[model samples]
Target: MAAEDPSVSGVSGRYATALFELARDERSIDAVKADLDQFEAMLADSADLKRLVRSPVFSADTQLKALAAVLEQAGITGISANFLKVVTANRRLFAVTGVIRAFRALVAKFKGEATADVTVAETLSDKNLDVLKAALKSVTGKDVALNVKVDRSIIGGLVVKLGSRMVDSSLRTKLNSIKHAMKEAG
Candidate 1:
């Protein structure tokens, strides 16, 4: 089980670190992770919700109260909702979405999960995903948890990104690289 240091970076890192510590203290790491995932999904699906959180024009009170209602109706815990209110009151709601993502990454780190963001041209089959996971585990020397994505512009093959590193086997990239090489040779 590889454990990452509490040390991450930027404003997002600070918010995530605080929330992660609280979750760890309450031994509700799993539940908090789930709640954050749900929050991310809601933010992604609702344009108005995204705007409300990111827009400075909305009063802190509006954000605080509206978010509280949503969290309460969703059966989220007091601490989670309280955190949102604090972010709102401080006018840090714009960081909320990134905080949730970073919190999940940190939680995964503490849980010994190797998170990889994988992008491909088409939706992958479970079998392909399993194979990819296995191959990634071998390469990374840790269990790999994938976040799959699609980019039709990939043309073919897949582009797997892990943190600052990437494996670009995409046909588009390959073609471009070849074209560059041919022009340079000529």
Candidate 2:
């Protein structure tokens, strides 16, 4: 199944499982997670890195050499450093982000924590953030660690998302509803 699978469907999970097993065997799960976090940050912060990873023209040798320099500059560990080199040598760098996320999910499972991505129109105060965290914990029955994002473009109110379900109560959404209602009434 691993050999014949198309990554378009369930790539991250597969790669994460493989990496997670390796980390578990080496007793470096925490270190690996931290390393992957750094790698993910690099992927986000460097457009050139993303472009380089996605570029098909770079031979595996060139990619591996470049990745080695990047790993050294970033102070990456032996496990993570070697993993990146292997990925580059095999031309699997494009899946770096997914692998990071998937590895995080695995780490969270091991830590007995749940990950919730929360986006709001504005930054919530720490007090409000705690309230939100408590509410989510009450519902999820697990320790929730939120990934918060602020988007001022949303105008007002909040959007709470837990997995696939979304509770959209933003001012933008309310205004759109009011507009739709007026048009229907007219």
Candidate 3:
């Protein structure tokens, strides 16, 4: 409903803001969000699709054609499909994931919601995820959406990033701190 803030700089942010505005005007925000989520999952699941988006060897025309087919196959249409096609035509396909993330952030902000990037040593069960989301919601006083990631290197515990604030409670960080303290004591 509002014009994209000029402060939202960078190619991805600008493009995402434009797309978000367009989707809002068209009353397709939810549909576009679903499409973007599906596309993001595809990117994460398929090495070839990730390469296609990131590689510079593909010409704009080739990218457009391939992406169109992929979108169609995925049943993504309407404003989301058009916006993605425009991104490909403009030679900004490599930044699609960033754009989608920016768009989601805008949507969440518009909805008066908060998002937390939660990294855990292992994939969380649905029940655990619900409990975490509820806890975050209580803390933020807003509906909290989680962007969950699994990092086995953490060994255990969770790392949560909410807005500019981060809570690093991972075993790795604790061990590193202890090691540093031991060295200082020695």
TM-score of each: 0.80, 0.78, 0.91
Clashes per candidate (backbone, < 3 Å): 0, 0, 0
- The local distance difference test score of each candidate is 0.82, 0.79, 0.89
Cα lDDT tens digits for candidate 1, 98-139 = 787678688778878878989899989999999999999898
How far out, in Å, is residue 108 in model 2? 2.1
Count of backbone collisions within predicted model 2: 0
Give the C-alpha lDDT of model 2: 0.79
Q: Model 1: runs farther than 4 Å from truth? A: 1-7, 73-75, 122-127, 178-186
The sequence of per-residue lDDT tens digits that candidate 3 reaches over residues 1-186 is 224533245888889889988888888888899999999999988999999999999999999999999999999998889999999999999999889878888888888889888999999999999999899988999998788888999999999999889999999999999999999999
The better-scoring model by lDDT among 1 and 3 is 3
Q: In model 3, how large is the Cα lDDT of residue 6?
A: 36
Q: What C-alpha RMSD separates each model from the true structure?
A: 3.3, 3.8, 2.1
Kindly list the per-residue Cα lDDT of model 2 for residues 46-141, writing each as its tens digit: 988888888998888988888888889999968888877877777787787777777766776777777777778887999999998899889889
